[model samples]
Target: MSKWNPEQDGTLYRMMQEVVASAGGSVRGVLWYQGCSDCNPDEAPTYMSRFRAMVDRWREDCGSERLPFLTVQLNRYTAPNPTPEADACWGAVREQQRRAAREIPHVAVVPALDCPLSDEIHNSPAGNLLIGERLARAALSEVYGRPVHCRAPEIAAARLTSPDPAAAEPTIEPTIELTFDYVAGYLLHTGSLERVFTAEDDAGLIPVKQCEIVGPRTIKLTLTRAVRGESRLHGAYERNPVAHLPLDSDTYMPLLGFYGFPISGAQYDENR
Candidate 1:
């Protein structure tokens, strides 16, 4: 959310209702990746309860008893967490994710314990992207009645080495940018026109607003500028937090909700 505090449970409930109508049986599948925000020993016990509630609501919306739902069992690389409560909570959540797939007919869990974690809470772009795409493929293969091709990422845990092997290295900007790519040209936007962004420097493929590839390589996004009544030239969605407040276009942009921190795909990163 824009801000975090207590009452997150209620917030999740409301969010579930909001998403259930559209994502219920109408959609092919649901990909849920969450729970790090509520890690606790007691929280673990309720993870399944909450997840089950959400799934039930989802199925009800479909007017059916089941929907293809895929989940990600998050990583623990960042935090060598010694806290028992936190570990217990995560264990419970992971169990719920895994069990849902096993117990439910159309559910699945994508493994992510080997990936890098952000401060031990969030997942890295490379890992996050793969999780999403894999979920999509799973749904396409199972629910949508299509034979989907899965591009699994080949990633290995890396240990940085220096002259001393223990010394800290200088800071460098991350060159790896993540986004959705297709083998064809031009993406389509569903709603009102947002500004079009042409990459200036190291900026790579950008997916913003509703406009799919309006230009050959250029992406059209509904611009959201922090400064009121100004156009956004910098196309980086996750560039800065304060940068995306006043959106220039409609709020129904599906890709907008996930602008920057995109799910990693296997095309770019391979172990060949």
Candidate 2:
């Protein structure tokens, strides 16, 4: 019954067409929530491309070029012992889902990192309700043109703002300032923020000493040491990270999880 897979005889697609025909030969939007099976090393990397292709095919079949597609970002799976590669694949799929929302037109993604799991990979009743509400909000705003606040907070930019360019070494402390978009009011967190944000240089993971909300949409992360080569910043970037994710103070929408965002002023080489 998984919608991600099309039957060999095109049963699922035919079913969709039949449903549309029953509904006066027109459809509103699509709410997609299945991606667990695709969360593997072989499928994660090409998720976005495959997703885009599917969306394109669906829209064409449905006779709409700009159909709204509301996607729920994959929630955490915590039952079976997951390997390092498995964890990475989960993160990769989530990031690709987020990217799909950003790069594809009329596509939107809702955060489910905070949703409770019914089992290893399924959402609990309450979690499903929350996801349903989020999808409805997205459909209203994106498809029906309702004035609703449906977008999740996303990382807009990350800048290396500290180690004060003028200050000498050894005594200097390094910091990276992250700016977020779609934040309703300010950002607030629950547990220790230290475990939520991380950085990676050519040498590997950089220890984050502290994280503080210095501005309405800004989070400043102080690193244990200065980064020399190409680096990237990650927030809640694991399969099930021990995180203190920030939420919008007003709407309480959780910030979208992200990975591998290039940190500006971190000696990043774009060519590489």
Question: Per-candidate TM vs. native?
Answer: 0.45, 0.89
Q: Which stretches of candidate 2 lie over 4 Å from their true place?
A: 1-11, 22-24, 165-173, 266-272
Clash pairs (backbone) in predicted model 1: 129-263, 129-264, 130-264, 187-212, 187-213, 188-212, 189-210, 189-211, 189-212, 209-222
lDDT of 2 by residue, 1-272 (tens): 12543422456777778877987998778888867788777878878878888888788877899988899988888866768687667778888888999999999999999988888778999999999999998988888889999988999999986454455553345789999999978998887788788888887888799999888899999887767688888887677866468989887888888888889974533233
lDDT of 1 by residue, 9-124 (tens): 45654555567566652555567677666456556567666677667766766567766777765545244435534444554565555556657777766555434445545677
Q: Give the C-alpha lDDT of model 2.
A: 0.82
Q: Which 10-residue window in model 2 sums to the lowest lDDT?
A: 1-10
Cα RMSD of all models vs. native, in order, equals 17.1, 3.5
List clash counts for every candidate, in order.
10, 0
Q: What lDDT does the true structure give each of the candidates?
A: 0.42, 0.82
Error of 2 at 129 (Å): 0.8
